[model samples]
Target: MGPPILSAVDLDKSYHSGSAELVVLRECSFALANNERVAIVGQSGVGKSTLLHLLAGLDRADSGEIRFGDRDVHAMGEIDLARFRNRHIGMVFQFYHLLPEFSARENVMMPLLIAGEATGAPARADELLAEVGLEERGHHFPSELSGGERQRVAIARALARGPEVVLADEPTGNLDHENGLRVMEVFERVHARHQTAMVLVTHNQELVSGFDRVLRMGPGGQLEQTDQEAPR
Candidate 1:
């Protein structure tokens, strides 16, 4: 009924490699609605992460449009784009991009700090760390934590901003099966508490059972639902 939380139309992106233009996304188009959970499954190099970047306004598409509600994401200037991203978008990458110098709590507090809330950030950060099951590890730096712990910290950092839609690029990629399930549980907790929409790019079909939809990226850089499996 309402406008989708995010959408892309006739999107295209490519990489230039010294006289060779490698096309990655070809007329890619899709949307994720409010409180919806979507899983993207495909083999390596299907431009899944690329599409996520485009959707997040981290990178611009070569042509076509990406919209966040009524805002044209592809048309915003740098400062406006940065503000918009900080206010409304959260991203978790396969490699946890936690700052090495900061503790887990500090890393999770950065977004709030940037938004100019100095007083209560630590408490908010505590809430996020606890939600992700990392409350005990908040004092540890990224190098001091395990791979799974680092990823959980990253997830906490992503949720710190209370973004409307979270874009996760292989959020569980490097974890063991048990760790992967644990990370997924943190996602579930986030959804239950915040009702954030999520677009997750993952290879684990087993994880798809927890999402509202599963769409696979084809060789042509187009997206298609694998089957009409009922939503979870």
Candidate 2:
């Protein structure tokens, strides 16, 4: 409905391990429109996660610029980048990186607290948990929840910061078919309700089909457009 919410230009990332340079992503470029759902699919080592990291400002690229509206994420320093990411991007991972010590409510509240809005943290956390279908389980810790439930909590946590873009890395990698589908349902709900642009890195074809567009990664830093409609 508007100009691109996120754009990656000539992105490249490489790591020097010992004497060899391992180039993970090369010249990868793409644009994600506002409220768009996009999937990144590829081989294990093709750098899907690396690309997500760069886009989410979790890491830096050797060359390239990630634009979120008017801000160039690559140019932000550590403090500004952290603040910018907290306010503008939400991130989810396959492992359900919830703290074992905190209840689901507290876990989701962590991001809000970090952003210095502790007063309404619990109320907002509860609202997000309910949205993700984890209202009754808000008192449970990570170890007490199932894989799907944990991911639901993670989804709630990610949305807690009220970000414009949500980046998920291998979100369903550790779940069974039923749980994975349930987790995906929650993702869809989040996207629809928040109108947040989503960039999901998933190897599961079924999951990839849920997005508006699919981008495939190839060796030597190639990104090719695949399906452009939501799979039915």
Candidate 3:
């Protein structure tokens, strides 16, 4: 692999509580190469989400550096960071987070709309819905879709801006086994089709098996490699 598309070094984040400080991450470090699909698994409350936030530049670390390609994400100004994130990173959450008032097509078009590409939003959104097997359901509202379908919309929304990376946090947590499997399949297929790097924070080992690598977060915010290759 060439230089990492994403890299973090000596990351540290903490919170103040009364007179004490609660440390979330301590010198956390990792790297993700282009087109790599990686899983970070650990028990709840191990700062898995925090790590994801810091990596995505959704949150900042008290100390350390987060680099995307060669640029320092932490060092960028707010506007530039927002633009960079929109253009380079996409995020999917366990909760679908769609607009209840919008149709599936409209919901998927949000990123493009925010990016001021209104003219092409409809076409791109329709294409993504079809790619995720939701073409016929484009007119449906969030309330009209199943948990899996909603997540599919969320995934399509994440890809709306044609981001280089997709960061998913417990994406299948709300689905049943069958639907969860289907969602994972969607993620795999989308990543393959787009050649986008993915950083997935999940507790499900089955989902982790399909990834290129798995890293487990140990106590004290240390990361250990679990797998070097995807399972057959």
TM-scores of all candidate predictions against the true structure? 0.97, 0.96, 0.96
Which candidate number maximizes lDDT?
Answer: 3
Local distance difference test, per candidate? Answer: 0.90, 0.88, 0.91
How much is the lDDT of residue 137 in candidate 2? 92
Q: What is the clash count of model 2?
A: 0
**Candidate 2: which pairs clash?**
none
Question: For model 2, what is the alpha-carbon lDDT of residue 34?
Answer: 94
Model 2 — which ten-residue stretch has the worst lDDT?
Answer: 223-232
Q: Evaluate residue 161 in candidate 2 and report its C-alpha lDDT on the 0 to 100 scale.
A: 82
Model 1 earns a TM-score of 0.97
lDDT of 3 at 97: 90
lDDT of 2 by residue, 21-108 (tens): 9988788888899998888888998888888889989999999899999879889999999999889889999898899999999999
Model 2 lDDT at residue 223: 76
Model 1 has how many clashing residue pairs? 0
